[model samples]
Target chain A: MSPSRRHSDPQPTLATVAERAGVSRQTVSNALNNPELLREDTLAKVRAVIAELGYTPNRAARQLRTRSSHMIGLRFEEAQEGTSNATMDRFVHTLVEATARTGHHIVLFAGDPDDPLDGYDELLRATAVDAFVITDTYAGTPAADLLSRVGAPYVTFGRPWDDPSARHPWVDVAGAHGARLATEHLLEVGHARVAWLGWEAASRIGEDRRAGWEAAMAAAGTSTDGLGVRITDNVDAARMAAHELLEDPTVTAFACASDTLGIGVLHALAERGLRPGVDVGVVGFDDSLGAQVTWPGLTSVRQPLEQVAIEIVDLLHTVLSHKTVTEPARMLEPTLVVRRSTLRDSAR
Target chain B: MSPSRRHSDPQPTLATVAERAGVSRQTVSNALNNPELLREDTLAKVRAVIAELGYTPNRAARQLRTRSSHMIGLRFEEAQEGTSNATMDRFVHTLVEATARTGHHIVLFAGDPDDPLDGYDELLRATAVDAFVITDTYAGTPAADLLSRVGAPYVTFGRPWDDPSARHPWVDVAGAHGARLATEHLLEVGHARVAWLGWEAASRIGEDRRAGWEAAMAAAGTSTDGLGVRITDNVDAARMAAHELLEDPTVTAFACASDTLGIGVLHALAERGLRPGVDVGVVGFDDSLGAQVTWPGLTSVRQPLEQVAIEIVDLLHTVLSHKTVTEPARMLEPTLVVRRSTLRDSAR
Candidate 1:
């Protein structure tokens, strides 16, 4: 036979296999769908017919009938000018593991350049992913507006400033709660004069952390004025701030907002002939890799990054699959990791 | 008008526009291809007619006539079990930037797991991408078999071991050259007896580095038999090896294959009241982020990760576009970064 003629042979469809196996169409469908329900003989006969006639289920046809791609988009917003924070990298790694378990793949896309107005419109228009997971929200970001306009399923890593109604699913560690825990640890240890070294006040996370510090001081009946609060853009600035803070002997301890700031604080203290945990106690937030490698290991608050990643993936899957999500907003508590940085001499 | 009737309208094609604008088909194509060639009046007239008739080019029909997808696939082996390395992360970041400049997007995929024997069969059967880029090669890997079976145009991040004559395009740093430079640096600094601390010897890069170390020692009139060569599965083993090497005062310096191993040596030496630069010297390969953060920062070799990333993308693009690649295999040289770890004193 000619190659074209041989290729034109009639292949058996599901109905043909059902007829040949001496069963109804519903019975054949049930055998394929729920094999445990059918008798062993019946299943064997159907499967034999299927193999003999080369009857293959058309996955493309099924996908067309059910408009589901089973793929999700992860929109990573690059740091405007500097490097991405370590927390974001950890989140991406965790998300990769979580998605692999469900037989789904993630496609990464970059967001629009940092602009107050345009936002993620360009990214949304170019990609046709079933869902989105956005990380690291900033104030005045157009993500919320674009999410509304696109009307696609999405989960955010942090709560937006304007929306307090919990309309969308979000997963965030209690930033204020963690900061309060750090401050209380220092205060309970017989340190009356404590300072706060943190990031700039532009970020929502920084503001929340600072608020927690203020609240803890107020609860102790201490004056908020002249409480050594040094804020800077990044680690280098924090180092300089720490240098200036050390000039004052009254500030006995410091509660830093992040681990990078804490490491910088330790380096600065060492430069001025002051030893951490001896002359002054230090506490930091976010128990990252930096916490382990610092000179006197950092005592900080540990945010559950893996748990957040798992819950975010679960939420996205539920939304995409039309399952009801019982909790719209989930807040995880951060725990304290005590190390040499905060160990008092008497306790040691 | 009904949608069906609207589709039946006699739309003006490119040929009609070319005729109406009194230009050749090539000229009209160039007007669309390179708009700067045509005068303002002529380009405006052509564009007006094209928009009025709602003419849209059928990219699919054009692709059928000329087979091209303008897409590339990036396949990676399972990530090694540990924290992500800085070199690989930086390489991926640079690859994304390089590919974006050429208006092509990279689709990242993992090898198939069900049929381990034919891992890339699923990807090969589905011809969605025009070319491929494979990273992180190992001996007897399914990727090597897949590349050979499919005969697809591709580029790799590392060289293959099984078949040196495979004639595949690749971009990698000169491993032996970097090792030789590192060994000579120690010798020039007046360190006579040096030991080698490394991981598995089965690795191609590992073997090359060992050869370089041996050659350097032999050329310096030093016996290679008594040289301390420690192979370990973990950093703890490396630390123990360092402790043993320090027992003999003859071994004055050490050469490590990775920065992590080098850090372990520093820690091991500190326990014995021997500082890195004062009592002994140390050198590490791959100037990763860990190298800079360590106390008395590590001195190591720095690979051009960004350059390799850009070159891989460029080679893949050229192969897919049927353009000639001037060089099939490219090797980049590594630079030495001197830090406090290898310096004789803090003053230096």
Candidate 2:
């Protein structure tokens, strides 16, 4: 599989066609596969450009020559038991849509959760998933090493946290930026002494998110002493930690690293008979289903997952066509969604 | 892509190897590709069987000759906006795991949500997804019809409700059986007038589930008149309907067709200052994240999604290997997960 990628990179055929047609690679694909999906004029324009470029619409011909599968392998990180903070489903949905237009499909498989590289090599050999798009940064480091060593074409949806020198194309959400927005939103709502409930120090993502709350508190001239708690990302553990934090009269709000942690704070508030937004404001990250449907709609930081998928596809164009690496990594900002949890009203 | 499936079906070489080797088809593939994952004795045994069966482990060679992709196409139904009743994610996780072991993968792409076949033809030609496994029974009719007409190999995860004459392999859960369990549980807990909150009459799955609650009520000899309300599956709509249902003091429990509706009932109860379990018992279908993580965990029907994935894979073996189909269609039962929503003492 890796050897197939080592062939002399093809000329910028699809990109040139797309640019000349003033449309996306996906649109060009749609013109070929589902022309009915496009307007008559758009379809005509795309077909004209495709014919002028001599871009072969037949993937079968390309496969015969280069063994190209036109499929990107993604190792699915299964949803954690009983948790709604899993973002893979949302990301995959958009990723599928983003790639489908370009006549590509995402090949989904489960690697041993305990071992990320467990079945990766076999998948490529057996399923012909010769290329990949990695999601879990922690596991992705090794995947990058293996793919790079083997010379396979691939991209990452997360930054290489442990490896500083790796130059593979990547995109990541600005975790600190999202957490800062969450913390700032809480402060704006008149909540003082907002505490941070986050994952343990070992997690780069957790620490990255925690930095935002710390920076915001420092900027606001608020005391951080005895106000922050770091634990494993679990509802029960975070809930117990939040219960202890709530014993202090001054802690009036929380900015959590993840929705699972945020839910724990809500659980603690429920136990203590404290209304979520009125008594103590709460904000979660990822804007997951739990945040959306929780009793007092939980305010959260929403990542631009759709945009992330689009960027990955665009990056694939560069990597596969061997185009100039204009941007090796992209850090997209996150937006805050305000709801009853941070609105100081509408709570039960 | 459809033309590729017209080749005469291959012999059951893999099945013979697996059975003689005292292993599964997955183990045979593992012996060929990722032998390190298996034990030394097991690998040796599988290799022996492969030799005796004269199986070709070289997919590259096979692909070159047959133009086979070994990729099963699936149209992703995106998660409903702000709803937790969506069950596609869980099903996909298991499907991917099940297929990976046998050197197969799911080619996930978004179809035009409006038209199930909107991008079907294009995806087949562009992605080389020569086979399929359909999930949405309603949209599946045309897909199955098209594939059968084209002589493509395919299986369905849902029953062919509108096409009983269809001979395609399928696996479906007993919706009525699941709903009956929910209603009877409420009855056993001293609730006589348990109501049914369900989808409108047009949905076959909805109607199937409704019959269970109806039968359970009749079996218990409880009057069900005015106790069943059908509407579109939405949280706010279901919540509004639940509010109206709550007006009748006799309606002490509700069995909903989906977790989204059950969450709605929870919202209505919160608004009326009524407790979920003590004042009103609520049960939802699918045991979705909403059911698991709601304020009072929702007691709901739990589909054997993992088992369904395994069944689909097993059916795939029979369909693709040209083996005699023992059971053209399989039906599995669902269980209930009891939680705080139905347990009176666990609520906040």
- The candidate scoring highest on TM-score is 2
Q: What is the C-alpha lDDT of each candidate?
A: 0.66, 0.81
True contacts kept of 1: 0.01
The docking quality of candidate 1, as DockQ, is 0.14
Give lDDT tens digits, candidate 2, residues B133-164: 88888533887777676466788888998887
Return the interface RMSD of the candidates, in order shown, one decimal each. Answer: 8.2, 11.0
Candidate 1 chain B lDDT trough over 10 residues, lowest sum: B1-10
| lDDT for position A98 in model 2 | 90
Estimate, for each residue in A31-128, the C-alpha lDDT of model 2 and write its tens digit: 86688899999999988877664454445445545556677888887777667765878899999999877767788878777776765665544436
Q: How displaced is residue B257 in candidate 2, in Å?
A: 0.7
Report DockQ per prediction, comma-separated: 0.14, 0.28
